[model samples]
Target: MAYQSLRLEYLQIPPVSRAYTTACVLTTAAVQLELITPFQLYFNPELIFKHFQIWRLITNFLFFGPVGFNFLFNMIFLYRYCRMLEEGSFRGRTADFVFMFLFGGFLMTLFGLFVSLVFLGQAFTIMLVYVWSRRNPYVRMNFFGLLNFQAPFLPWVLMGFSLLLGNSIIVDLLGIAVGHIYFFLEDVFPNQPGGIRILKTPSILRTIFDTPDDDPNYNPLPEERPGGFAWGEGQRLGG
Candidate 1:
């Protein structure tokens, strides 16, 4: 059946992105179905420590809310850029990608303690967008087909858009901050003069997610060719 085939194709998305998106969808559906409540899933340090509701740590980053425009928008962006990053810069580096997720999530959680943020799914999405945007600095993006800017400015643009939507910019700012930290430590700093790599991916993670002989024939797709108008332009020039 077409539906089954489509499902199968979607299931073939890179592991980390696929898993994260699936978690978000399922959590949202559960809440919409009234099977779970946001209060139960939100991050609460006291509940996590005293009542042992540690699942909140992960769940808080899973549900964005019941099915709606904001949820859909976040999910689409999450899936698209997460997949692009995995298949582009991280083509064969599954362990490194996983480590980035771990690092970002850990940092966000720490920041959440000081802030009043309950759900961090949006922030996590922003972190992904920020990392992807930074790594692909040359990529050209069009915001609602009205504004054009290079990739590095994408996160800030999103923050401004969030402000326009009357959403708190705190979550977006948290994501951007965490993302910049990761980018600086993992990508930027190590390449600096006399700078050594401080954020090495763990060997155990490498062993599990990355194999020596995996996908020998795999090759990353070319960056999105720039030019021409398209819906939600997020592409690079040339094939």
Candidate 2:
């Protein structure tokens, strides 16, 4: 329950099945504030200092260093995975479900940043996987697309790329690490042992959207996964 500190049970009783709805809202807000670029946020001390906003982390999540044309498509993929995660955990209280995923993303980013300063390349090892980790928690990931399944271990894959690329590649790795921590610490670790200590949603919301109900928005994702329920559930971002 120590982690329950990140609660947002008020969004929806069960919250919404698709977390992208929230992502969209947050992203939109950042765009409106003209903070969509890395220059405006990561380097701008004046804006952040002037706002005096405590939750500056939220602002950072809104800015990505771009992934070429794959950005929009990948974000959509992230939303899909997040939606499923929210629905599965929240059940009736979708808000908590959404919060869990969103929080995981936020936490991983922070953790990645922290670790990057010390072990730059290692931070990304966690980031790549999270990007396509919707099915990551499963013992065996059913990749969204493809005939068979595989651990879309994007984090590590990206890490390999970073080690080869050098220097500037650190930021991308750090970004993915941030997303990985959110899921690993909050869900995977506690739930690891044999029976009782597994992570379980606290039944927080009132009423909300249920998942796998075949909602129209329910899309088929082309997700990547790691090994086991949380095996190296990680990835490194492309810079």
- Count of steric clashes across candidates, in order: 2, 34
Provide the lDDT at 18 for model 1: 84
Candidate 1 Cα RMSD (Å): 2.3
**TM-score of each model, in listed order:** 0.92, 0.46
Model 2 spans > 4 angstroms off: 1-40, 43-51, 66-80, 83-93, 105-149, 162-239
Q: Please identify model 1 stretches exceeding 4 Å from their true place.
A: 216-232
TM-score of 1: 0.92
Q: Could you give candidate 2's per-residue lDDT for residues 154-187 as a string of tens digits? A: 4444455456556355555555656555556555
| Candidate closest to the true structure, highest TM-score | 1
Q: Which lDDT values do the candidates have, in the order given?
A: 0.86, 0.43
The digit string of per-residue lDDT tens for model 1 on 1-239 reads: 99998886776687888899998999999899898889999999999989999999899999887788888889878887888889988877999999999899999999999999999999998998898888988888887788888889988988998999999999999999999999899889999999999999999998999977656444443346456533235767562
Cα error, residue 88 of model 2, in Å, equals 6.6
